[model samples]
Target chain A: MTPARRRTRSSAALRVLFAFAALIALTSVTAVVTHVVNTSAGLIAIRGGTESAATGDAAQVLASWTLLESMVYRSVIERDAVERFPDGTRIEFRSWLNPAFITGGYSADPTRTGVRGALIGSLWLIVIATIAAVPAGVGAAIYLQEFSAPHRLHRAMRESVHLLAGVPSVVFGLIGLVIFARLLGPLTSGAIFGVRATRVPTGRTIVSAGLTVALMTLPRIVIAAEQAIGAVAPRLRLAAFSVGATRWQVVRDHVLPQAGPEICAGAIFALTRAVGDAAAVIIVGASTVVLTDPSTPFAAFTALPVIAYQWAMRPDPSYRGLASAALLVLLLVVVVLNVAAGVVRLRARRTR
Target chain B: MTQDVGVANERVDTLSTEELTVTYDDIPVVSDVTVGFARGEVTALIGPAGSGKTSVLRALNRLHDLTPIARVHGSVRLHGKDIYDADVDAFEIRRRVGMVFETPTPFPMSIYDNVAWGARMHGRPSELDAVVEHGLRRAGLWDEVKDKLRQSALRLSAGQQQRLCIARTIAIDPDVILMDEVTAPLDPISTGKVEDLILTLRPDYAIVLATHNVQQAGRLSDRVAFFLVDESRAGRLVEWADTDSVFFAPRDARTEAYISGRAGSDMSARGRTG
Candidate 1:
């Protein structure tokens, strides 16, 4: 065959292979989604009574499978109700999008396991963690990248920082448990500041958890900030220097301004990790069933990931639904944060 | 302006180097080069690549301090004071002697802020607007950028950016200005504009320009210093003379051959003579 004909044949074969691969992916995704929905619906049916439970479970399974519920009703399940199969197995299809699911305080009772407190707690955790980590991380990065001499000590310092970033989150959690929870209990619990101390001196409060998360995030932020600061062109610094600006002046006016958006992006990424982290918070003693809003950073708190982890560990179908809903919320928060960071990065690029 | 010109010229030596040697990582690039810049006059350093013209210019304002490996020996005096003295602050020296680079580097800020940054760093000037306007006008960029002062400096074209950099350098009102091939990367038209700016600025500030472009050195400089890399690849001053004499009756054979475009082979031959 001619080269053109051979090329066309090969191209057609490649297209066919791509189409086959796509079909396989689509099939696997559909299968997994169907299995999840059917299993949830089946479990709900066993708990729900015989009459409306079966109808609701059937409708839910169909809705989840077809994705029609989202398009039509903007939800997977419309209301908290029960239905049953002919054999007397029951199912409960709770509306995951209900305000009560998000706003109600946590309880052992699956119906009252609202994520409001956990959501608020996660937000506080991220905010406090970001506040504590960004400056410290960026400062360390600046020192290492700009000010520090290229001597053996600085090289060792850089290597140590990289090593810190590679350390497991559990190690940081252990540190938090020992230091923030045990050693600095009075300070973290605000007992030293003359505030009313109602709880034990375990320091298993929002402040402790936030600090732990901050420690977990610090290494990542420092590495990212170093890269961002390093990415700035040397000529820009020289330009600042030539204008008679001091070292600090050059860094503040030129380096920081140019690297700010990227640093922010890195900080936000670290915050996202802190927000989703469960292992570290768990070790630091964050509760999975917080019933009230944390009034202060010193107050005991639980985060969304902790709550989701708790629900996921349960065998109950309702708990599974709650966990799924919590995971969805976590996903939404991450997406929103990323989009905000993207917008900031674009604005920074435009200005530069 | 007329009175300022007369006052500026009255000070004969604005800045001078005494046995200046610059080493980067223990290797000397500029060795024992002594030169003086007269007030209100343009002094040009002309050389082939790697002859340390730019390095010498940088050393004048303590720009070498920024490079960790760079070690500057000997004294650089500004107004008869050793700038490199232990008690002397490099920051103060840099403020008094501003510099422009081969490439335009405006700060990532508004055009107005880019020009005003130097003044602000010195201690926020009370008359910031006037300073920005004066610097921009002096660099020949005010008419184009004045209406859009709030716009980002990076948005300016390459030539405008270079001029903005010049404006930024001049904003602090330094006693001397160092230009290291400031127009090398620009188009001929932009080079002409910058050359015109240098000529216009000659009456107000002591200017040290480093350029390999022989015609540019001859055109704008009152005096020209020829530097060459010896067999050791260390830059040494070959000749320093008035522009007229340097171009017409060069005392050094190397300088003469360099001006006549026959220096390439002569330079390699002279490298063996070292």
Candidate 2:
């Protein structure tokens, strides 16, 4: 074929391919827009106390929101309690968006779901996990990056840490179960702190969940801290050394300052992962349905992810909305943590 | 060959090395390098790349301790005491014998803090502000950076950062200062500023400078040491003498060739004869 004719033929074929891709994109955009425009966040077939598609007399309390029966109507739903908007998104807020729901507990009815217990349990998990992981992870990173020579043993240790980051979170939960819950039950169950419990408190407490999160977060923090440490300019270390600073002194004053923001950013991301993790919390003894908030660290506990996990798996279709709402709350927390990570990263860039 | 450099025995030296040899992983890179730097004088170390000038500078302050595979033999003495003795600490020696690197390294901190950091590392000085001012003044950086002491040192230009490094070294109050091609990364104006700083510092401290610039060596040095690589590719000290003698009346044929541009090019041949 001549050059012009060959070019024209290829251009025609490219035009057809572009048109096909454009058509697919347009269709997807339309479908998404239609769903978003037609559906409401509060329109999930939910009733406060009535099983509505309203044509049938099949009303069940479990299909409605978590509110008192007096506050709800046959179909008007949480009419004057929790909150009622002009647009009829009444019971939606009572069960999933109100202060009561956020600060309350769970029941078998699914309509009475609240996440205060899980929220507090998650806070405990994160606090203990930070205590367990940050120091250990940062210290290990410093030693590996600054002190440890690239010999066989240190190399093996480094590689093992990287491999640990790849291990499933559920495995960390098992480790927590075997070690904290069974072997060190007294310590983990807070009996060592002289707190009295009804049954001496089983190993499945906030302590076990926190330690499990710690274990899973440790490898992530180490990996991130190592990368941050490695990115530090070698020139800075040399400057510190030439000024008569010792090895540890260099790491503390210069290296650590330079790498701090990046390390903190990494730690936050790792914490986010641990906070969103469910399987590990479950395996470590956090029940899917938590009814009470533990007053002390040694009491039985549950996390948001665990609650979401349990509710989403219910045989009844109405429980699915509650599960999704729980998940959205969990997602909000994750988003907040991710925003924290981004802030740290921006600060790091500015300092450098 | 080193014994023939008869001019080296003249001064009351502040720092001296005897039969010094350095090796990396058991392979000798620089061998039998014996030289001295007298107080109130600048000793310029001129040589080609990979001839071990930097290695020697690193050895002077025990900087080689940072590398496991690098080894040093023979004795380096300061004020008549061998610094390599086991009883002596590397930190103590480094504090006494400071170094300025080829590239400027300004810490990500305030200008005042950069100058004061070294002083604080040893022990917090009671009068840190006065000490910082003195060090910066001595480095010729006090006036330029006086108003911005609270700003980050990293914001300074390349030359200002280098002077800040000098100020940092001075803050520790060292007896000797090593400069490793410090002006190689500077513009002409900055080079002039640093060279002037070196001249002012000459009367108070023993300075050893490694440089590829011949004219700079002639202008800034009182003494010169020329290093060469033999067939074995191990660096050896060839000549050491007063700057004028080394530049105007080189005794060694190789030094003459290198100095006169007959050895290769000026950039390639940096040796000056005793």
Candidate 3:
């Protein structure tokens, strides 16, 4: 080979070597930091005589590297270790995630504290929010992108919707508080609907909270959906039009189906935002300590984020550990949502 | 040129436009154009770029209504009915007058669905399979695509996609088929196939084709309307006559200059020479 070719080969090899070194360094630093954090948190819990401190550390380390939290928890439960602390306090190691932990209602008693009720309530909130937002958002997007005339009023409406997306979630919560909780109180609480059941005492129930989150994320869905619809080729619209399709038929048959994956992705994004939202839910009077499953839209509700936030604010070590576990669950939920979005996008691409 | 209008009325023209003017945002692109298309005949609208050839073809089927700024004046009559009347639905007008665009545009669907889509819009027809087969065979695509009818229309070659679009138009069974530079983007072989398809389709549909290819126009059209951008940059009909007369013995000097290679040259020089 020529000198230049040889030099090029050496440079390429050097680049590969550098990239390998960088990846190794990154992994080592991350492992060292995680180990330090887990060890310190564990030692502090132990000093405070928390029963599940050691197991919690093991679970955290396992969760950090892999999906082995359940295995560690199971091992700890089976061992049933009883150890005496320096202060002569006897502690028993136990699994933090049990069926009772997943399904039971909240309790102020630390031993019985679980997020099952909150989890169910949050899921219901997502369902309600999706129903409230998706249709309205997608419809508004279709109107703006496909049918709306290019006039000042329509332009202003578009700009206002875009502006609404940037507004704080708390502001929407305030709007929900006034409109849903107070103004529509009787209607939402099933008093006017003739159900004769008021689960929240006040009208600040899951219905109100769900609507609040829906309002908060409506603009995001509309913008995403509009962009998706707009991205369809002008040729496709022309083709459909040339074939004698009406405005509604063309949009329903060609435009909406093409934009489906992006619409779904946007809905998932709205759900992710709603799932982690605490301030709006709090303002809309989602109970901080709900003890029963929300059986209906009129029922009182709490979500994992609220419980996690409440737990983190407490001055107890065990409460902080519970908060960490709750955060892990929230992260898992977000990952699952993103994976679902990916599958939808893949299917959409394949359809074309 | 005016003599053709009298003859146009004498014959049972399938579709006709009277003094049709198309404007976008109040600027006229096609002005005061009177044309008629007879059944079993190809009428080619031959013009330069920006001469409003596509606009005129689009106006025939009311496709310009989709553009927010476009405004079409005068009447486009299909089967003696004024399509621009307030009570007339544009969709119904389009159902009678289908169109094929310059670019191939197959819907993002299966080949069968692409052809069946138009027929199914009213409701499911009892002989749906027969209709799809007829449309595909008429467009000369059935032999190539018969085995993979379930495949996505997008997976076809560029030429095949254009043929699929033709099949889709034919499936609707329109009285008049508007083709806006339909073969402009195709290869020579594909263009040949499409040109053959257009000739085959001429027996049943009043086909109005707009194209920049003078040779293709001469090959396919029975009568040709030559449009030119005037001093105002508004497209106006310079000459409309039989294709042989227009191609060989043109009446208008501008039509001759455009048909020849001297279209963009100094008009004043040609005027002084004449």
Candidate 4:
């Protein structure tokens, strides 16, 4: 080879070598940073918060502590309280007098203040938002991608959907507050069950928050669903139609199955956004004193973010520390959910 | 078979076309072209790209309805019945006049599903599994894929995929098979296999094929329809005659030049076979 050609080949090889080195460096840095962050956040210490040095149920052993303690806080302390078995080994105990056991206390029941309530509540919001947004958004996307002919009018509508995605979550909250919380709340509440259907003046209830988040997340589902549907080869669609498949059957069989995983991933992302969002709920009017777990859509409740926000703003140092822990819990929940989505997407791609 | 051939040739002698024209958006692509496909015979359509060979085949099958912009100026009749009659359904036309594409366009499904798709779509009775198997056998793919009927059609080699497509078209038991360069995108071995299959299948179905390969036309078809092209002008049918005569004694000099390697031809010269 000529000198110039040899030099060109050498440079190409050098560029590849540099890329490999950069990748290795990045991986090492990421590993080290993750280790540092995990250790500094006191993951193990958070578990220690539930441990107690005192022995026995407060009502059975320390009647004094039980008598003076509020039902909510005392209930939690009693549940975690330790007792020596007859054989002399100590173990944690649960008590019947705990306010969480019978009536809602701090966060519905203080005795049950583990990740259970946060998990169940987060799942509630996520599932609700997914149910509301995924079908509506993905259906719209399929219609646009497969059925709608390209023209100025259709193009404008597509652009409008994209623009709606750019609108802020707070804006969606304002709209939801006006529409779902105020206008539709009483109507739906009265229709479902007979009561003086009440709507909170501040629109931060779970139902309002979920509807708001669904509106905010709808555009993402639509865009992603369109992309997934578009990824199916045009020839397949032609084949279906040529075989006398109705437009509906073509979308149902050839388009939707191909797009299903992507739509699911979009739903998962939207759900994560809804579960982790605090600002919209704050704007709408979330409650601080939720004495019971949310069993009804209209039930006033405290979600993880709202609770974390309240705790973080408090003047007490211990409460701030508690808020930091809650923040950690929230972060973990989002990461786990996103990772699950990633796994599903990867599996679908491999099969395709 | 000889009696059938005698009758088919008599029909060919009497068959005629009247003022057939195809236009897209008021622009005539093929105009005033009159042609007839001989029954129970292989008729090769040889042309350059954009010469409307495949378009004519599609019009024959009433497949032009798939393209919303395409419009035909005259009627296409099969056995003296107008293909575009008001009562005629495109689906019925497709059932009678099947087609295979230039490229192997198998569905992203199992091999059996690929062949069974047409039969199922046409509402064939149950026992389509047997039809699928029989089609595969006819297309000479059954022995190789009998054990892997459930395997994705896309997983097959290029040759197998092409045969799978052929099997798919024939599963509906079409009276005519319109193939648009069905063997162009294949290896020499695979091309030879398909040529053999075509000759074998001619006894069962009338075959109309469009191909860029002059040698393939000479070797496989009975009658060849030559479509000629020139820039700034719509394509036209230059000649239609026996394949052997067309190859050896073409009426048009351009056709002669195309068949022999010595002269200019519209086809890609990268992979020529004498």
Q: State each model's TM-score restricted to chain B.
A: 0.93, 0.92, 0.92, 0.89
Candidate with more favorable, higher lDDT: 2 or 3: 2
Candidate 3 regions with alpha-carbon error over 4 angstroms: A1-104, A193-199, B1-9, B264-274
Q: After superposition, how far is residue A48 of candidate 3 from its true place, in Å?
A: 13
First chain TM-score for all predictions: 0.78, 0.76, 0.77, 0.70
After TM-score superposition, what is the CA distance of residue A75 in candidate 3 from its true location, in Å?
Answer: 15
DockQ of each: 0.74, 0.59, 0.70, 0.25
- lDDT of all predictions, in order shown? 0.82, 0.82, 0.81, 0.69
Q: Largest TM-score belongs to which candidate?
A: 1
- Candidate 2 clashing pairs, residues 3+ apart or interchain: none
- Tens digit of per-residue lDDT, candidate 2, span B172-236: 98989999999999999999999999999998888999997878999999999987776667788
**Which CAPRI level is candidate 4?**
acceptable
- Winning model by DockQ: 1
Quote model 1's TM-score. Answer: 0.85
Native contacts retained per candidate? 0.89, 0.70, 0.87, 0.11
- Model 3 Cα lDDT, one tens digit per residue, A1-352: 9999999999999999999999999999998656434421221112222434335422211111112433445444323322223332343333444455566667664545678877887887888889999999999999999989989999998999999999988888899999999899887776776655645666788888888888988998999899899998899998998888998989989998888898999888877887788888888887778767788888888888888888888996567656666665665677798899889988878766
For all the models shown, what interface RMSD does each have? 1.0, 1.2, 0.9, 3.0
Task: Evaluate candidate 1 and give its CAPRI docking class based on DockQ.
Answer: medium
- For A1-352, candidate 4 gives per-residue lDDT tens digits of 9999999999999999999999999999998556434321221111111333233222112212221232335544444343312322333343322334223335322223333344445566676678788889988898888777666888998999999988887787788878877777664333445543254433345676677777878888888888888888776765554444556766877778777887777767767876788777666656665555667666665667877778668774434434554566677778888998898899989987
Residue pairs clashing in model 3 are none
Q: How big is the positional error of residue A206 in model 2, measured in Å on the Cα after superposition?
A: 1.0
Error of 3 at A96 (Å): 6.1
Q: How far in Å is the alpha carbon of A349 misplaced in model 1?
A: 1.9
